[model samples]
Target: MKKKTTIYDIAAKLGLTAATVSRALNNNTKISFNTRKLVLETALEMNYEQNKLALALKSGKSYNVGVIVPRIDSNFFSSVIRGIEEELYPKGYHVIICQTHNQENIENEKINSLVNVQVDGILMSISNANLEANKGLNKLLKNKKTPLVFFDRKKDIKGISSVTIDDFKGGYDATKHLLDQGCKRIAHLSNDRNFEIFRNRYLGYRQALLDNGIEFDESLVIETQSNVQDGRRAARLLLDMEAPPDAIFSSSDFAALGAIQEIKESGFNIPEDMCVVGFSNEPFTRFMELTTISTVDQFPLDMGRKAAQVFLEEVGHTEDVKTTQNIVLTPELIVRRSSSKK
Candidate 1:
């Protein structure tokens, strides 16, 4: 086995003290520019590597952050990740992403694992699973104080910063748009209310209906997962009702796509017979062609950048508990062919 080159070996080769080599490698201003350049060139020639663990111990920073999400397959999450990377890459920090698969236990495990590895911070979007007795929150800083920030799906914990869209407004705008298009009977496909984001969306939907003199019907609302199959099933169930809905306001783009597919398969013309609006302005929402569903744009890329900014701000404070900051971005209701009455 070949032995690894160290600063001590580089120092010996240069006939200089180990401290001088270390200072030059760290780019300390005290070291002269010529000496620093010479040390760097010689170290590269010798294949020298700095011990990251020792540096982390000395500086109290891993220069690595953990980013947890429900899933990366979705366009929204992937775009958000791209934004985070764009902001943090130049800062000499890289992210380690973890997917919770909408499971609370899995989310907790990921937090513990990240903490064990001594990550500098953690950014997450909580899972769909109910967190009545969540252990992940407790396990976050048992060993070390890690900066934590929430993006999109988040909780209202004191001293914890979060960046999210105005979900209530998104829901209200989507529902109100369908109403403006002369949709009398509107059905809502919602998700679990255990999450604040979903609950706010549902509330917005109901508020729009109530404000427009339409009675909010519980039967017209169905709680389903944010997936294509679930959306299709919910659409079918609504269609089978005694008085079928003329429009649908879904909280997920995938679900809205499923409902559109089901509506078309049942020989219905979109906007003519049934109008539809979905959340998350996903990539497919624009190029849906036949469906081209109307959706609320949450600006996920900006959300990720804002979340990274919050993490940076939180990490800057030297105290164990940092001050909280809540940044709520606006949601844009995009008008598309799927919901246009013309």
Candidate 2:
């Protein structure tokens, strides 16, 4: 096996002390610039890799952060991650990403694992399955004094910071847009009510209907997963009704697409016969050029940036002083062809 180079090897090669090599490698301002440059060049020549664990032990910080999301493939989550990385990378922090697949057990395991590895902080979007109070996760973080920031999907736990868009307003805006387009009977494709984001969105939908003097019918609402198949099934159910809905306000873009597909297959003219609105403003929404489906822009990138900032602030404080911040970004409703019946 090949031997790995170390700071000691660099020091020996450069005829310098190990302490000087270490300080130079860490970019300590105490070390002279010329000496630091020489040590760096020597370290590079010897292929020396600084031991992160040793530095973490000395500095009391791993300089590594863990990020947990339901799924990395989703555009919203991916963009949020990108924004987080963009903000933290320049601040000398490394991010480790974990996906939970929307399972609570997996989310718990990931949290425990990241804490065990001595990460400085954790940023997460709690899974749909984590509907209950995350007492266990909270206890673990509190014990470790690790800063935790929740983005998008969040649990209502004290001493934890969270960054999210106003989902209730997003839902309200989407539904109101449909109502303004003269959609008297609007069906809603909702997700599990256990999640606050989905629940708030449903509330917004109901409120909009009431405000517009339209009766809210339970039959017009369908609980569905945010996927094309579920959206298709939900749309079919609505279409099969004795009096089908004239519009749909979906909680997710993928479901809205599915609904659109089902509506077209049923020979319904969009906006004329059935209007639709989806959330998240996914890229494909515009490409498909389906009737401009009104959508809520959650500004996932900004969500990520703010979540990272919260983590930084929490970690910056002393362990004895814990500060929590709840940041809610405003959601913007983008009017598009899908819901423009006028």
Candidate 3:
């Protein structure tokens, strides 16, 4: 007796992805005609059957989903999970939360474990660790035929659905607000440029400066991880510069708060002598007793819910019908005492 042929076997023989072979067999227009013809010829040569692996074919569904995040402690990530739970609970789905703590190894382990357990789907916010060479995450998921959705911090790969806010607009709005306050020299505190969200925010900041006739100074842009200590250290460095900025826009709310503390300790008044802005709209940003920080709200809860919705839409559909969708929500700027000089 001979074993049945599978798309994985075909993919391995052709040095291509199983997904590409499946798409070609389904006559997906996205694949080039030459590639499709080659795939069809190979399928006929190998006597391959047309039982394409579909999400609906999976039996004994555990009705469980795994959500991987960098850390669960952040208000943003936690709130997004809360939203995911709220949307999934009514559908008789259980969510297993996994934290990577920004480590790629832990992330890979969690994803592998989830796939082995045959979870129906996975939702994740990718880590910033450079794992492009590995290419294990997407391959594992696709090979397992499990659906994937990304919320918040996501990879920009094709074929994966994602829900996120317009980070560029968020950054632009944050900087524009500070410029509107009549601050001429502004500094930006940013994080790793490898992450699209952080990079977009920084780009937005520079674009805002350029739009307002302010020169883009790389010296004024300090790479801060957006924590309190990082913010304080960054503020100290900016103040020591020959020409210090009177305004600062940070990619992290916690970093912005740290900068505020450092500014005050150094004899600068908020929104008077030095204005500050931050991202993430962390709850503390709006609840300060003396000074509240102004920041951009990424709508993490809504992002989570939308991501769950994307999963629901894709689940139980054939691979031929599972089209990738990208959803971007709008971010709102909440002005407060920190940067609102006017």
Residue 209 lDDT in candidate 3: 94
Residues 1-342, model 3: lDDT tens digits: 998888888888888899999889766789999998888888878888765234226445677899999898789999999999999875557899999888777888888899888788999898854647425485665584888898877777779899998999999999999889999899999999888899999999999999999999999999988589999999999999898999999999999999999999999899899999899989999999889999999999999899999998998577888889899999999999988877
Q: What is the C-alpha RMSD of each candidate to the true structure, in Å?
A: 4.3, 4.1, 13.5
Residue-wise C-alpha lDDT for candidate 2, range 203-289, written one tens digit per residue: 999999999899999999999999999999999999999999999999999999899989999999887899999999888887775
Clashes per model (N, Cα, C within 3 A): 0, 6, 0
Error of 1 at 203 (Å): 0.5
* Candidate 1 lDDT trough over 10 residues, lowest sum: 136-145
On lDDT, the stronger of 1 and 3 is: 1
lDDT of 3: 0.87
Q: How close is candidate 2 to the true structure, as a TM-score?
A: 0.85
The residue pairs that clash in candidate 3, if any, are: none
lDDT of 1 by residue, 140-227 (tens): 6343488888899988876778999999999999999999999989999999887899899999999999999999999999998999
Evaluate all candidate structures by whole-model CA lDDT and list the values in order. 0.89, 0.88, 0.87
Model with the higher TM-score, candidate 1 or 3: 1
